[model samples]
Target: MKYFALLFALFFINFKQKTDKLIGRYSYLIEDNNSYIQKDKITFKDSVFVFDNKYMPKGKISYGNAILLENFINTSLVITIPKNQIEKDTIEFYMHDKNSSSANYLDEVTGKGRLIKIK
Candidate 1:
């Protein structure tokens, strides 16, 4: 029983370390009907994700916490913001590349986007 407990603890720690590789910065461009392009930035660090929009008020930022979930043996990260917080949507990022430098993300409301590691 002791051995089983120790093994489970190690596994959890290892899983966390693997998910930590997603920590980095990413940028994406949003095109509007007016033919204008808007750039957005998102950064993942520790267990928090920060999103910033260039046109937003100075010093304004959106914050969300991330949770790593396992589905049928595959792992994914989901970022969720409290309902009382900013109106921005939640995002789910699935790590694809082995290096964890890039991911495919789906915003809860705005569809999907490619998250390329910039840092």
Candidate 2:
């Protein structure tokens, strides 16, 4: 019984650690200005992040991208963009929700939309 309890606790801890790996890929929409509208996609693959900003129907229009860095502190994911990429668009990392199976990504540049995981 004692060993079974220990094993159960360890299993839960390991599961949480695995879930934390999805941190940066999750995002949502936050509009300080109600001037624009639309949705977007934020994805993680091959150690790179793709931010598709084809949501907004106006303005110059652009796409955002970023690279993921291993989190040094806490279980959160750390994200950064290259200088060239930053010159064209803005990007950032968002933390994942504990209760969510998947998370939504916020556009750090336009701050207009979110990237939801496809089922």
Candidate 3:
């Protein structure tokens, strides 16, 4: 019974990581003093996310890894993206620095934005 429970836990964890992968491009509309209807982009591929701003000042490029958690995706920014965030044309995420030094988030860059993805 003990070994069965351990295996179940392991399987659940592995399944979460495998299914929580972030993929493709998600964009957020940036409302600035200047006129524009369209805006920035966040591209995710192989569990990595990159930011590319087409407008707005100080449009810098940054990237971060989408670390898989048991029930969420962590980006070292304290943002917990549930599996359901992929619905519709937006991926809502919260932002706050965790300042972790773990290997999981070692390559993540610092940035923030509420993205809207076109399906």
Candidate 4:
């Protein structure tokens, strides 16, 4: 029994480390009013797809081969980016809405930001 518990602990630790390798500290530059604004540091948790932001509740993020999607729990809406849409230094975000349309970040919650890898 003791051996089994030790094995389980080891497995869990390894699992966390592997997933944490993919997740770490990152920042998003929010585009607003013809200006690029910086949001803040967001810490991503592995396995569960959660991001930490002090201004709001926990945010859930989904990742694909090239794009990372985020959904807020309080409003509970899905935001995503298609894999093919990534450019040299910018990522586009599509708004979650009834109508299918490109999201405009001038005055909208779902805004696209040019992501720079800072980790």
Q: lDDT winner among the candidates?
A: 4
Off by over 4 Å in 1: 1-17, 29-38, 54-110
Candidate 2: give the clashing pairs. 27-104, 27-105, 27-106, 28-105, 28-106
TM-scores of all candidate predictions against the true structure: 0.31, 0.31, 0.40, 0.46
Q: Candidate 2, residues 1-119: lDDT per residue as tens digits? A: 99999999999998775221222343434344653233354555533444455542221111235333332223333333332432222333233322334453323332232233443
Give the whole-model CA lDDT for all candidates, comma-separated.
Answer: 0.41, 0.38, 0.49, 0.52
- The candidate scoring highest on TM-score is 4
- Model 1 earns a TM-score of 0.31
Question: Worst lDDT window (10 residues) for model 3?
Answer: 55-64
Tell me model 2's lDDT, rounded to 2 decimals. 0.38
Question: Tens-digit lDDT track for model 4 on 1-119?
Answer: 99999999999998775221235555566678878777665554652344445555666565565344445554635555565543233445554542335453322445555444454
- Candidate 3 segments whose C-alpha is farther than 4 A from its true place: 1-19, 29-39, 53-78, 99-113
lDDT of 3: 0.49
Off by over 4 Å in 4: 1-22, 47-52, 63-68, 73-77, 84-92, 97-110
Write the number of the candidate with greater TM-score, choosing between 3 and 4.
Answer: 4
> Per-residue CA lDDT of candidate 3, range 11-114, in tens?
99987773345666777543345433354566666544555743322222232343331211343344435356654456654344466565544345343345
